[model samples]
Target: MVHQLAGRLNSIDPQAGEALRIVSYFDVLIARGVGLDGLLRGAALLSGTVAGAEIRGRVTRRDPDGHAPADAADARRRSSPRSHDTWTVWLERDGEPGPDDDMIAERLALGVYLLEERRRPDSGIDAIIDPNRSAAERAVFLARHRTDPETRVRVLATPADAADTGAPSAIVPTRYGLLKATLDRSGRLAPPEPAGLGTWVRADRAPESWDAAIIALRLTAPDTPTVDATDLGAMLLLAQAHDPQAPHEDVRALAALDQRSSDVLRTLVEADSIRSAAGTLGMHHSTVQARHEALTATLGYDPRTTTGRMRYTAAALLLRLIDPITPARTPSA
Candidate 1:
């Protein structure tokens, strides 16, 4: 039996036996058609450590116990050989590399690549969002697919999951980073993921919607997951024109504030009264007042005043625009 042969091989040569076991393990996973989560779980269990993968902008990880930790730990990583540098798999281990580390990483990466390839749609969604594609070509693809004229485009920090309603989606490369773009006919604003919702447009004008969606996505923050293009109004112009590379004095000043100060300032700006801000921040009104005065002195302007509020709002928006929380890379493909 293969099990008897494997046992004999293990007794004869430990390293070779381990390698064979690794190969067989992944082969069975592939045969079972496990997804990224399953693949990471399998790798973690086999290595007795944590395993993770970053495909496009979506990150998934599994600890050895099969639990998904919220934070990523330091780990050794390997890029998928088959992808165009779009994906990577890593093992979070403490000590020196194991003898089978290379083999485990290689199989993990390959499995992730194959799974992603299988999930890729053979549809016009790619062409419709591709900026380099000619308008005529995009139009042709739209017509071929019979896309609705009222469809809106949404750009997300992560890929859509099974919970999401079925929509034509693709990974779009943007100046900020790779984002998962989806075409939605539902016209709903609430998305489970952090997203930028674009304006409703005809199939031929989808590119414009795509552009607006990217801007809206950049404006989203942890507290604000989804931003609608329709809600932006004229602020969209500011986002379009602002260059993240050049930090203005106000932006620089705002950036210098510590987390505590930043939270207080944001609460102050949104709250109608100091008491309201204090309640929202879960701090005493007197304590909030003191902090507000201190922030005014530190910021060189009272954020509560009309003119000061405008300045703080602009600076805050500009800050979020320049410093997105998620990590992204330029498209290699």
Candidate 2:
């Protein structure tokens, strides 16, 4: 009956018939639960061009042959209006668009939106990390995940989409902007560069772990990408003492130093001897000695001394906490 109706429509209006066919094709794909790849492939075949969708930070593209192209440039394309502020679907046609081009693009966008809704995580990571929620509510979520109040878990915080560990995760807002927090049970999670691993704590104390994780993330640097909370020990206390509005004199001084000078200062404070610091920095001992003298004169403290080293380390850590690099805004599901 559907085919006969389509035939009759084609006889009267070919464009209307093609529009109906495009709608029916996407409807069937949706009913069969075809994933993002299937949806893109169907759109590409129907439009006789390359189709693509970028959801969250991930991009997927498919050519008419159902294969991903190496370099699918964005030219002569018709894109659907941005949906949910996180995704967009488009078709890159070769010549003038066909009569049903707009319809195919619209249906592809709708298909992707439906698929994202269906695949959205139902996990309670957001509730578990949210401080606004009551303890009873958090406990209920923990129980649903088979985690008791006393079971220990560490939170790993990284930049958004930085890690793909299959652990339960969520994008959480912090003083440092949006960060992706993943709950790790085994304590062996190796997140990507510039990540932080919070100290192990009870499930009920997850909020504390999250706080510590953000602190650790701030402490990460070019030389050290991942920082463990336990290693920080008393330094964590110093982090709480910071006042961003009224910056410390030492932190301000350290921030003034150029990158090369900062590296030299960091090496001098961390290394046991001048020779060792020079070796680590791959600089001649004389050059390092000269830079050290220059830095000491500029900062009004001899960083090689025990007290100076202590002061320099504390100031450096604090400087990281106040880093001004703003993160991207939180993304919608």
Candidate 3:
């Protein structure tokens, strides 16, 4: 089984070697009958952030001021989670999904993979700065200082291969009909096709190889709940590209409108809220519609599509709004 998995890793693309670590984690886990869901629940306990992957806590320590090293297992051991010893969380084994030696090896491999991927530049997208912007200030390092003033910034990225490639592998393989759904949720492995596989497929007709990457930014529409540093960087770039003066946001106050009239505008954007903004705000359906009307009069963009949202959020954050070059208001996200 180890040999088979090794061969699979060898077959992965060179640009994707960094991500196979995550694959190895799952490979070992599935070989032992432990599924990713178990890993997910286990991960939630240690890391405050829960992701649908084999658990190895995120470690963000990349600032001028030294910070503590972050690790999933270490975090789990240290955190005061509710389910430290529920005992109900048993490992499957012997034809059933068990968290045995094989599972341990796989999960560990996954951890290593994610760790290395975070270090990769491609996956390490800068959320604060837009790729379209000019000057060093348009980079994540500089832009973060402007976005969130009170933040203690710590940036995390998906594994390099994981973020750039196709759909992740779906463990607990079911019938063929359900394979795509399973892949979509795993968020680990990658496939080349998008039809029945996932959304990470390559496109030949694109203007550049990055066409798929650009499309992904548009389609991902990541909810605030599932926000990742890499995705955040992508959004910032998209926002800057949409409007140099606007910031990307779910909803922002329209300076031009009165509070009462603005409330109605918020309702419009709320009704057709983009990605995860609606869920984050715990807002009503009409909220997006309400916001849209106001944005149209102010930020100069639509909130319904990716370009629009990018413009809106940037305007909201004032990505490049340029307000007297306020001395780096927010710390970071």
Instruction: Give TM-scores for every candidate, taking all chains together and pairing residue i with residue i.
Output: 0.55, 0.57, 0.21
lDDT of candidate 1 at residue 74, scale 0 to 100: 48
User: For each predicted model, how many residue pairs clash, with residues at least 3 apart or on different chains?
Assistant: 0, 0, 46
Candidate with more favorable, higher TM-score: 2 or 3? 2
lDDT of 1 by residue, 1-333 (tens): 234435767999977677667766775786566888888889888887778877887777888888987664444433222234678677775666666666787667756755665465556675786677877888776765566544444433332221344566655435554456777756753455567787777666777778788778778777877778779888877777777767678898998898999999999998999999999999999999999999999889999999999899888887877663342222223
Candidate 2 lDDT at 22 equals 71
Cα lDDT of model 3 by residue, 309-328, tens digit: 54544444432232111010
* Number of backbone clashes in candidate 1: 0
- TM-score: which is higher, 1 or 2? 2
List the candidate numbers ranked by lDDT, top first: 2, 1, 3
Predicted structure 3, TM vs. truth: 0.21
lDDT of 2 by residue, 1-333 (tens): 234445767899987667666766776786566889999999999988888888887888999999998884565555433356578878876667776667788777766765664455566776787777877888987886788878999889888536468787866446554577888888877888788888898887788788888888888889999999889999987886777556689998998898999988999998999999999999999999999999999999999998998889889888888764332321323
Candidate 1 minimal-lDDT segment of 10 residues:
324-333
Candidate 1 residue pairs in clash (backbone atoms < 3 Å): none
lDDT of each: 0.70, 0.77, 0.32
